[model samples]
Target: MRELTTAETVREKGSWLFTVRDQYGELDEVILVPCDNESGSASGQASTDGGVEAWINRCTHEAQRFDTGRGVPMREGRIICPKHGSMFDSCSGYCDNGEAADTTLPSVDISVRNDGRIVLTDDELTFVGEGGIDDNESDGDDGPASTSHIGF
Candidate 1:
């Protein structure tokens, strides 16, 4: 497991976007959003008041980058996609409206240490600096890696 950032940093911002290397050494972006219950209480007893939840930064509908521009909007326990106004339950990544109904955002497994260090728990080390793609899935072609982020 690799430490992504300290708990205090997440607490202050409420959410954060970062990139980590997958098991295959490919760069994958993730977003860490703090979860709060209906009572406005955090999930864990950590000093940060809530456990930081991680998810892939892509929107399930059009596969747009949720972390782009102003970033995903959080309301109550849901994340609102800025493009289509789709609302997704932050915890489950479930969307019930817009073009993304009945879908869910990809989730990234993560854990927060007792001392407040958020770390990736998927056996992949979270890269702390810079970003690069070393994906085996990518062909030698230097064309666009994806078309999901188009029309945005």
Candidate 2:
């Protein structure tokens, strides 16, 4: 497994650390965005100092899977949903798409292990952030980017 360049700390409602791990199996990745707050609450929590949050990459129109490429989580801030051009909150997966549904990206149950390693289960990996469409069975042309965002 390789950690993509998309891994970085960001400031949203709280201090969040985002990392996209390339599992390279049935699912191409496990995007982990964890909030570092005193309360560690996902809602109504703000990182007054400076932090970040992360959301899934599912499409807004049909809930199709969106690609984050090698530059995932947008270090500069904001991930444009590749499918519908909707800009989702990279930290929270909330979309301003303005519809009756008011849908947001999916999130995982994140926590720190005893050894200080962020342990995320398979079920948690599947539902990270906003976009919730599975592309595990996508075609060859639909695979994730093979580039690196770190050394760039």
Candidate 3:
């Protein structure tokens, strides 16, 4: 199993993004969204086990990405689709409403370790790195690069 990130980091950020390659050699990404605790509260408890769930980052209806390299919009244990209004349960990934009604998001297997380290346990997917693939990565420069914010 390849370690993705710490559970604490996912808990803090509400989600963590990582790149992966499947058995067919297709590159994709996974989003680890934080799940609610037993009391229905999404916060206030810190542990090394079982507070995050991994989804394929695509909606079941239109294949629209839930995260889109940004944070997922969540509401009370449900992951909201940005394109439509479908909501999937954070724990089960079942969508009970909207265009994705009665469908479930395909989940990627993940394990939260005793040491607070989150690892990808799915044999079909290999961990590449953190964050989604940058679409702008190429060998050629389009033009003279301008000094932008964040020191590019």
Candidate 4:
């Protein structure tokens, strides 16, 4: 288990982002959002554990990013997909009323430590670093030769 950040830090924002390398060794981004409070029905009502939950950053409908390197837009314990406005419950990750209805966000395992820090506990993922995967890094090859010949 690798400590990602304190639960309090996630609760303070509408959403949190982190990076991890999956079993395939490809970097992926995950998101953390505030779950419902004690009764577990209302969102962002912080408790001792901070009501934190984790999920893959992509929305199921269009694979749109939930965090996109910034905080996600949320309401009442739900994560709203900015593309089509599908709302997913932060706790259950289920979208019941939109293009994503009947689909659930892919879950990422996580746990809080005694010290109040949240950690990535998924067996198939290794902690990479903070924030989303940096697309700037690339292979030595110049990718595809630019077709437009309006060269520099």
* lDDT measured at residue 104 in model 3 versus the true structure, 0 to 100: 76
> How big is the positional error of residue 108 in model 4, measured in Å on the Cα after superposition?
0.8
What's the TM-score of each model vs. the native? Answer: 0.69, 0.44, 0.80, 0.81
Q: How would you encode candidate 1's per-residue C-alpha lDDT over 1-152 as one tens digit per residue? A: 76778667765765677767666766777777766544332232332423567778777888766666344577877877778888877666778889899997777777777888877776555564422223213466788767686665
Tens-digit per-residue lDDT, 9-90, candidate 4: 8878767788888889888889988775565422233444557888999999889998876689898878999899999988
lDDT per residue for candidate 2 within 43-143, as digits (tens), equals 45563222334344455567544444333433234545555566655545666664313666666444443333333443424423222224333355754
Model 1 vs. true fold: TM: 0.69
Off by over 4 Å in 1: 38-49, 124-152
Ranking by TM-score: 4, 3, 1, 2
Q: Arrange candidates by lDDT, descending.
A: 4, 3, 1, 2
Supply candidate 4's per-residue lDDT for 119: 83
Better of 1 and 2 by lDDT: 1
Superposition TM-score, candidate 3 onto the true structure: 0.80
